[model samples]
Target: MTDYRAAVQDMNFLLHDVFQVSQDWATMPELAEMMDADTARAILDEAAKLTETLIAPNARQADEQGISFKDGEVTTPDGYKEQFAQLAQGGWVGVTANPEFGGMGLPKTLSAQYEEMMCAADISFSLYSGLTAGAIMTLDLHASQELKETYLPRMAAGEWTGTMCLTEPHCGTDLGILRTKAEPQADGSFALTGTKIFITGGEHDLVDNIVHLVLAKLPDAPAGTKGISLFLVPKFLVNEDGSLGERNPVVAGSVEHKMGIHASATCVLNFDGAKGWLVGEPNRGLAAMFTMMNYERLGVGIQGLGAAARSYGTALEYALDRRQGRGAKATQEPQAEADPLIVHGDIRRMLLTMKAFVEGGRAFSTYVGQQLDRAKYAATEQDRADAEALVQLLTPVAKAFMTDTGLEATIAGQQILGGHGYVREWGQEQWVRDCRIAQIYEGTNGIQALDLLGRKVAGSRGELLKPLLREMTEFLQADAGQWSAEYQQLADAVKSLTEVTEAVLAQVPSDENIINSVAVEYLNLVGYVVYGYLWLRIARVAEAQDALGEFASSKVKTAKFYFAKLLPRIHSLRPSIEAGSKELFSHELNEF
Candidate 1:
């Protein structure tokens, strides 16, 4: 496994050079002085130490030991309980949480970089804390002041963990069919009864208590999604004196036997008349859950980027160290059995592809993080709205594209190691397995595509597309540099994407099934073009940096590779998106 030092440096580059997040952090008076470059760097260094020394060292062992579920109690692997305690005591859980509730109150952009580092180090271990952060955000935004005061501080301090209970056995994407029932009682509380499957961190021994943000339907509420309401159901009810009371009705029915992320317990939760309190207004649980889901969607994207970084690091090491066939143009005789794998152009191609995608995804994640900050802390309403709109539009793309790239990058990395990559000891195969879930869990990439094409782009008659296109056009027009063939290629790719978007919009509504049929392809097209734009941005920055002269040269070369090898996918998508829905719908259910 790769250490966290390199990951932190990459994160700093994305934050300071690629995104210029300091300026955005300065906008919020609360965060202006607390998150300077020095503080940020120090935070990164500490996180690296904690991740490399404490969390990452146990990654493989935990995966082997897995979480044990016996007699309704979940026991984490050895050392996890203590490490999780240190994680909470260190205040890492509250990096981006509100200050009013005993949190560090850092900006989202900085926290995003931290998240990437953590995920790269050990994704399974990180999920235990990540879910708490997501649940805290939802509670802070929608839960009552009493709930916030009681739970946020404890959650931030790591005394308790939190889980989002939305996916039942029958309902995942279509939350409209969720059967959880919430009946009001005389004491301003409700009894929640339902089973939530695949709930990450739902049952863990790392915390003293677990808080569940459950979605259930209320009696007399409207039907479908509108009838859903969010509730805070704790594992053990807390007494007024901050002591633990009797255990609530919520119990872990069983822990799942998953393909990866074995350390993080994915529980089947049975909320059998669990005592609960509504977080927000009735019939608006989905709206509140969206707040958490959107944040998590972006976090999942970071997971993809982090996994890519790990894959790249390991593969790069192998390529440089492992001896293989001689170079294509070897001028000198080989001294050893063979040459380093890096000598091969094909190997270089794979490495550079991984590098390009990882770096581009990093930049994109930071960009979205900055947008989230602006949405939350901008002084003007219009600025906030604009930032929020961008966040909404790009969230799905970030989730789908980053993970798709992650899976591809990890596979490429594993290929670099050949047969050694498939084994368990090297950890290469584990990266591939752990990363696979990022695409599937956080609203499958297919669903993300549907949301982007069906809801985001065409939702408002291309209103979102117009602003994004204008922004890209302005950026390309502003970079008036000479002797930059890669920049020109990127500009062409952007123009191609614009035309494709317009064509898709024109054909989508006329044939209602077109969007669903080609949503994945359209997403890939947009992803490639957007990444091309990121490569261009990175090249421009590298051009001006003297400290990283050699690195800048590599960036230029990698950007060229991206344009030449990767961006052509955008053109491939045009016909696919225009193919109409017939191909997908052509097969009848009985044909199988």
Candidate 2:
């Protein structure tokens, strides 16, 4: 198996130094009394140990063994159940859930790093807790008090895992065409009958029961998305006293044999008159599901970050150890036949690119984590509103850019490893396969681009952009002399982004396809600028703590490299976004 280690040093640097999450925790009553820097770091330390030791060992083995379906039951690979039990017992599953419900209730920023580490260690296993926690978020936010009382504690304890079922064979992003039906019975429950595909953790032997958050339409409800309703359908019926009664009518039709995450049971779930309870209200499932989706979208971004971080770690280790190339300068080991791969300029370029994306992605992900925590835990309504708006504006960027960079970073790592990266034993190719899904799932990157440029930016007519814009200005203005030129680049990038945003918004009324034609570029522009600002933040901190020596120096150099190489790519996107949809629309289906 490929070696794996959590980036605990950098994670703490981000939490305590860059973000200074201690200040936020001290101010928010939701976590002020219970969480501190010391506690959060301790949690990270323990999580690192578990991830590196227990969880990671199962990754390659699971891929080799793969998941199997017999009758209606799906079995996880060996060691998964025991490791999952350990994960539940370790309290990692509920790292950020409410303490009243057995969670640590720490801020999302700390939990976000833990998620990243889990993905680095092993993403397939991590999906169990990731999806469950997202389900817990939906319940905490929109479920009735009774439902919360009945389910939150057990789910938080990981006694029951959870799954979100949304996509049907006929519908994935377009939920309006969904054919799942939920017929209300006299006992205040509903009978759901439908076939939902691409349901992750839909069935597994790791937990006693799987709680499914199903989106189905109710009879007599209005047509389209407005008619959908959210239901909590358990794999096994939970009695009034919270113990398992009988098996619900939900079954795993079959588990997908996919490109990656072989241990994670992504199943085609068939609900035939399954007994389920209403979650939010009738005809409001779409909105309720978004609560879970917005949370999971960030999780997916972290998955991308995790993939990048792990791939970089592997590539860096291999480059330092693998000896095949001669040095451009004086070789450190003059007596040796050849220098390490690190001597090659092209190899360094690949490594530096991975480092830039991984570190920048880390900072960017943490920034969004802070926004999400504030959106949920800020003491005042205005603060919450501002943070919520920032979250809304950045979610699509977080989802799309991180995954896109993650795929790129993994491929770069594979390139660094030569042929070894492509083989199963090296595990770099697995990184590519696993990271590929993040871009496609949770609304494909195409859908995310449209959501960002159309719904979040153009839909609000620049109203939603102000919160992010104001913060970008504040971050740029707060910088020291460490990265003055990069600061200007960031400022200019955001300025151009603003101009293009306004231009696109103005023409949106006349050209409905304008956002579609340019949104991918627009979102990429936003992401590159965000990452540029993040790199500046890291470098500024590194400059202030120059006593740290090479660690600090490396960061400064990488920041410079990012500006020289990556950030300039935004200039290319501007022309593309400015080209408008006319040329794109001019082509017919058979034009090629």
Candidate 3:
């Protein structure tokens, strides 16, 4: 297996050339003061060093050793403790946390690059800090001043860790039906009692305490999702002086044995009358949790991107080094018995397919990060609102579509290795397994599709999508020059997306089940269109570079590959989306 290398060069290209985030930051005073262009580049360089030297070398060993759960305590792999401590000491746990609360307070655009590097190095290692970051964001936004002061600093400083406990054994997507109970106390706290399955970082020994942001029901609260409220339950209680107190009843019943990411602990937590505090207002818990969930959804998308990026690097190395068959035209190495895998047409296809998806997804993820920065720090309310709308419209696609293609890219990478990929020694199989879970967790790809088509699009009466459509249309209306053909193809794709959306929304009135039936296809269509738009932007930026170096030239080539080959996937998805629910409803469940 090839050592994991951070795509620092590509990341710099996106930050400086493609997005020009420094310019965007200058418009927002808060962001402008945060850091300059040199500082951002320097930070990325440092992160690249840390991930490559420290985190990545432990990934294979961690996977082979897994986690050791004994009695009630869970222990990670051999070097995890020391590595995590180093990560925390470097203040990486709060790379994007509030500086006022011991966090670095960096913008998402910059931190996002750091995130991708971490995930590529070791996704299992990244989760402990990633969940902590998410929990810190939620507390910063919604927690009371006292709670924020108590928890955020500790979490940000890496003295403690956090987890989101939303899924029960019986409920995953349907949060309204969860049976967790939160009883109010005279001391103004709540007593949480329930079981939350599939909680990441629930019982890890990397931190002193685990802060769980739980979803439960209050006694007088209304029924369904409206009644849900968010709570903060800790594994070990904290005293008034910020010292560790008695242990709370929140315990991990067992850690799940999973197919991949063996280094990360997936626990089934039991809250047996655990002491807790309210996060947001009563009956508004879902809203508060969403602050974390949205951040995580985007983070999960990056997880897929990270896996794909790593897999691509490994595959590319193998393709260049592993000699297979002769080239179609002639043997490049006349003295050699055979040629490298890169000389074969099918192998080149697989490598380019992986490259196209990985690079395009990276660009898309960074763009989403820019929108997030705008949503937070933009000068005007209208700009912030516009950024927020785009975030809403694209969050589902970022999570679902990225993971779908991420899995595809990983598999293609694995296939490039043939028999070697199936065995553990090559490490390609592990990536394939790990990438698969990204599509299933956070929310299944199917559920993400439903959210994109049903809630964000049809539920909003297409208001949320209009902002993105307009943005893409405006880009197409701009000057293209030599890239006119690619721009036109993207324009056609955008048109197809708009038409398909309108057609689906039109059918929703008469065919109530249409959204559920055609949602996955519609989401893919939207994904391909959005990707096509991003590819155009990438190609344009690469072409406009003063010195079209290897990196810039490759970007242009990859963008061309995406348009010529992958972007047309929208065509097949469009017909499936337009077909409505009739064929789906025609079959009975037991027919098979």
lDDT of each: 0.86, 0.89, 0.91
Model 3 clashing-pair count: 0
- Identify the superior model by TM-score, candidate 2 or candidate 3: 3
Clash list (residue pairs), candidate 2: none
Q: For candidate 2, write residues 1-592 as lDDT tens digits.
A: 4579998888898888899988988889878888898998898899898999998877889878878889989889999989988888877788778788888786889889999999988889899999999999888888889888888898888888889999999999999989999999999999999999999999989989999999998988898889989999999998887888999999999888898888889999999999999998789989999998888999999999999899999999999989985777665577888889998889999999999999999988889999999988888999999999999989999999999999999999999999899887888999999898999999999899999988988889888987778778898887357567888888898899889888888888899889889999999999998888888888888878867788888888999999999999999999899899999888787945
Clashes by residue pair, model 1: none
User: lDDT by residue for model 3 over 468-545, one digit each (tens)?
Assistant: 888899998898888888988988988888898899999888998999999999888888888888888888888878
Compare the candidates by TM-score and give the number of the best one: 3
Candidate 2: residue 126 lDDT (0-100): 90
Candidate 2 local lDDT, residue 430: 90
Per-residue lDDT of 37-147 in model 1, one digit per residue for the tens? 888889888888888788877888888898999988899999899988898889998777888887888777888878888888889989989999999999999999999
Instruction: Show model 3 residue runs off by greater than 4 Å.
Output: none
Work out the TM-score per prediction. Answer: 0.97, 0.98, 0.99
Q: What stretches of model 1 exceed 4 Å from their correct place?
A: 1-4, 331-333
User: On a 0 to 1 TM-score scale, where does candidate 2 land against the true structure?
Assistant: 0.98
TM-score of 3: 0.99
